[model samples]
Target: MDDQRRIFLATASRLGALAALTSASATGRAQNRDGGHAYPFSLGVASGSPLPDAVIIWTRILHDPLNAAATPRLAFSVRWEMAEDEQFRRIVAKGAASAAPELAHSVHVDVTGLRPDRWYWYRFMLGDAVSPVGRTRTVPAASGMPKQLKLAVASCQHWEFGTYAAHRHIAAAAPDLVAFLGDYIYEWGPYQLRHPKSAVRASESFTLADYRARYAQYKTDANLQAAHHAAPWIVTWDDHEVANDYGNEQDERLDPRFLQRRAAAYQAFYEHMPLRLTPRDFAHLRIYQRYDWGKLARFHVLDDRQYRADLACPPPGRGGSNSVQPRTCPALTDLGRGMLGREQEQWLAQGLSSSPARWNILAQQTLMAQNSQLPVVKEGDGRFWTDGWDGYPAARRKLMDTLHTSRASNPLVLSGDVHSFFACELARNPSRPASPDNPLLATEFCGTSITSPSRPQTRTEQYVSMNHGIKYGRSDKRGYMLLTITPSDTSAHFLVLDNVHDDASPIARAAAFVVRDGRAGPVRA
Candidate 1:
């Protein structure tokens, strides 16, 4: 069905849900054989893609969220209410959204006509049962400059590896926004050599139902649920959303059924997340949108996986992957090949150039800096992993060039998927370090994964040694970063967990850095 008809039906059902709030007859449609208990809100509630005037509130209804029989063919009417006060005494908006079975009983309420730069409390109701109360805030007015914004950066939470203790901490800290840079769910199935053995699933996620089951498993975690309930999220996908290291039309496995798998995965992603726009097609999702937090920040959310060029080098006798030296492979310098694609690149440039926010943040997936691992024999040359920005040199250079000329005040790039923290000064040329003549144009803060295993600490040190512009890095611990942005300065605290294997592990600060408002690079603070 089209969106307008679904929305209209949903709005009309609000009165029905309200009238049935005290009745068991209407709510019986939501019940399943789970020993006479309601579990429709198992996945919890979430809000995302916040704007000054509107925000998206979402929830899925299922008695058995982890299995396909949980959601039947019939639709369930759901009532949602928003209030300015936590007590819900001050009601701002009230509406009904139908949990359509076709959409996996997922409700996406694009709430409009709300105040800006303020906190709002909301909840969902079915019959007499109410969901957990969630807190979400809209952005400040476009022309106004807000005092501060506390944002939590997170990504790459592989379920089987560890528990989501980091998300629990994020919920308690209560940032204004959460930026998930992708790898929300890993595509690989259960593995034998993983910690916290409780999280392993039985099979890989290929079909739409399989993907939905995977998401349900992850969302079932109490800690991850708490974080979603705490604040609105701005999410973008990486390679794992569809397949492992899949680029453009190519999957790492190079299976003939990759396209169908991608379509199923995309549909499942849309059904699960709190997004404003629906996908136009299976492989085509307009997730690369923009957001503004008053005049203080403008976030350019980017999609780097769908339209990116395939990996540059397929090492001899194997599939398309691994690293390659620039001197040996001349194709590494192809300016025509891209990471963000041509259209996204243009859109990003235009947005960055025209934005009035004090901090122009490029929130994207994967590393943007050149992390070279060139052999000693090729000392002066650069070679890098074909999976990140290093694979698309020309595109990275163009992005740097755009940042240098943009009218935006402070250009900050937030990245994830590397499973390590990297604080670096973005240079137009990575072969040379930042100098007085070649000034640094932007700063990048790459957050570590919440539960995903980190690379060797030695590898992080190696990257730092190879790239002089990189100021600080650590891969020994797993946690998220809390970014506090003010008009005068923006600072990041790397919050690390003592032991992810232990759910009760204590969290401590690993490192901290600040970038002064006008400065183009990060300074140890």
Candidate 2:
């Protein structure tokens, strides 16, 4: 057997053993195609960008995802079906989707006219070969009220770091919605701890083809495939999706050719994702939009990287991750600088004011609460990470003011960029202390990465010490967050694995917090 085949079989065996741990059945079971061993659906399938009436079903027809040596330059006719039953007894929607080569033969079936708040199973077929069955569901009607909502927040699954044990856990949880807040695919080439039989490109991804190859490599993992096939997802990109710590049109490496690279990356991202909207131009790719789960919650998805001003503290082209005092950096306090741009900020403000849901959620890419990295003893005075909301103080203040003024109830923020779990309270007055007049404005739950390595453990003294708003924080292990929302309360559980390197790693809940109706902060539960 070829080395790649051997490695794939070994990983498949490990995943099969771990499959017993999950309650939900796994997807992406390989099928024999033709007399010859032709693997057409190698990347598996995904469904995302859901709505009350519409949901997208996606699959890429790739005979060779990792090695695109020879281009067939031919389009394939792919048939798709949506069923009300897992056994495919009653079919709801069935149609033929063309997998065009121009778009990498990726089929995105925008299934519409479906009933709200309903579950359905979907799958694809090419010739006599059948793809894995994927499960999907539509959100509740805009004016309707859902009694309960289960959302799994995940991010930063670096392929080289470890296996996607966390994603396996997410699939088993079977959340109604999965929110992926960026770093969906790492642009850099594979490094230490590359999985066995895993194909790693030698050079970093830059061109459209290079980025496509990287995505294919990551999608080959059965565990990740299971997670994607298990539920419908809402996705947004972070820095690693294009370039590390890239701001607006600026690249961290200070490369003049970065915009070309950015364009290619954006195109590839759109092609691979199950997005309803296609990119008109690489410079104008839009992913920020809103979704409502009936009257239960209104999710305002924001893009913080696309049209934002550059980093503040060290300034552009300085190549630093250190924090700075507000006095030291004049630009850090600039009110004109923005993270979500003016247009998106206005849209968010309008959404918050006009939202009719019981819970208002800001589902975005990065942390919104101010987090101090300084010593615990220096409580009120310290430096902070420039990459997060702390660098855009004025912008964050504007959001806080909007949330405080809006009529939206149980305002909450879900974030997943820092690769650390944080349960924090957004203060009404960000620049000042929290008091009765300026008390906790909203609750923020920042989930850790799906498989990304944890940051260096901070001193125990830092927990709930330096930052008055930080109710809990942990950077020791890799995991995801499970959020259960209802009319009366919203609860968040931090789920972690004992070891990600082991496919059968045990899953455990490290901590959990609850925010009751009318409460503005998270209380330990």
Candidate 3:
């Protein structure tokens, strides 16, 4: 066996031994929740960061999810088990992890030494309360190419706007993997204009405690919890997780204490997420990473918000995004200004160049293709939104150049955060038609939000009419994208809900597109 495989097996064996030693004591502690304490698994059980032989299962012990003070300062011993069946008749792996108050009483157990390409059921125990059974699966073996992979892409769920009916449908679909491309929770809440009756939080999240409580409130949704239990997730956050339209360390308000606020937000995100790595400190957390789905696909998950330059030429006093014409905003073409920053851009270049997978998927936030608000009969006439790829045209060109130079196979980008569904073609110059000289580099499908409201559908239609590269656009729907990847082609279905306000809304496919293997653009399927 390889050295890496051997080391993983050895670590798994050591963990197994340790679990055996603590099983009796842990079980005893679990039988009586520290003398009648409230049930701890209120938020839910989740598993993520899946590998061929391992997956990270997570849960936070919270007697009262909204009130952090309700949790004891002492560490709680949480036992977890993984089995091949829902009944857990044949236990495959068992372990115990400490739910420490320092980490918000969260438990993360990296369960390893399992076969690839199959489903496993897992759960956590605290006192006599057992968490909802979660189902997760490992990817295919490194050298193996699976026949297919079904992925559901979703994001931008504003709680008060509507119920999470989209997530309910996603759980019912039971995809192989779920990719959440940012805005897991809106930093602000209780708009009052939306559903004032069902407000989770009355104020915006600005501190660690506030962020934690906000996450707790969102996690209380049964549909969201069901989605977590349905499949393993791969997540990346965007602006709203910290503050809307914030890039790097700067908030839209340009608050002097933005970094401190960012630090708190980052900590709370770590405490709640099913991530593999812990943040080094409150000041910095690296969320950009890659995941391989066997030899079929490689997911280059990005962190565009944390390392990007401030939005170009915000209105004189404002610090957030604004629509502007390129003729008036020369800074829009600054070559030094970057979306992924230098280091991450270099890393992505290397990954795409060396990737052996058949499909290289860029799982990121926002749209990559050019979307001019006005008609672009000529270059300078088009008005662009400064919040997305249009804000950094040179950086977009650099990324397109990398894709062309590296020749990444079947490059497809999955995006969210615009609260709209968009199917577009990526090229060096998206305003122009794709020709031999100006070839397509990748295909993009940007999903609409789970519950968040978007602009009117007429505006989307206008933008689609103006932008030649955008094959489809729809802002009226609220839902997720279902992608089916095979050796031959990748089919994407834009699934939408009949009513976001209804908890039991019916879901239907709004559109469908397909990108053939080795092709770089999507077509109506």
lDDT values, one for every candidate: 0.81, 0.80, 0.85
**1-525 in candidate 1: lDDT tens per residue?**
863344334333332332232123123343434435555776678999998988999988865654658456788899999998767999999999998877888899998998888778899987666776777889998989988999999999998778778887787677889999999988766522223555655678888888887787677666777788778999999877877788887877777778889888988899889898865686676689999998899999999988888778766543346788887777778888888888998899899989988899999998887788753333338677888888888889988888888756899999998899999888888778788877888999999999887779988898788786688889888999999999999999999998787766789999999999999888887
As for TM-score, the candidate ahead, 1 or 3, is: 3
Q: How many clashes show up per model?
A: 0, 0, 1
- Candidate number with greatest TM-score: 3
Q: Candidate 2 lDDT, tens digit per residue, 1-525?
A: 963354334334445643432212112233345544345677778898889888999998876655654336688889999998767999999999988877878888899989888888888988877777777899998888788999999999888677888887777777888999999999876632235344455568888888888887777676787778777988889888888788887776767787888888988888888888865787678888888899999999889988888887555555424478765777777889899988898888899899999999988888887776664343245676777888788888888888878867889999988888989889855544578887888999999887776666665237447677777888888889999999999999999989877776878999999999998888899
Question: What is the C-alpha lDDT profile of model 3 across 1-525, one tens digit per residue?
Answer: 963354334333333332232232222232234456555777778889999999989999876655678778999999999999878999999989999888889888889999999889999987687876788889999898899999999999987788888887787776889999999988878522223445575599898888888887787666787788878999999988898898887777889899999999888888888889865777778888999998899999998888899999887876889899989999888888999988999999999999999999999999998999898887678888898988988989999999999988989999998999999998888878999989888999999999888899999999999887898999998999999999889999999999988877999999999999987778898
User: Candidate 3 — which pairs collide?
Assistant: 30-127
Ranked by lDDT, the better of candidates 2 and 3 is 3
Lowest lDDT sum, 10 consecutive residues, model 2, at 20-29
lDDT of 2 at 488: 95
On a 0 to 100 scale, what is the lDDT of residue 331 in model 2? 79
Candidate 2 collision pairs: none
- The per-residue C-alpha lDDT of model 1 at residue 372 equals 85
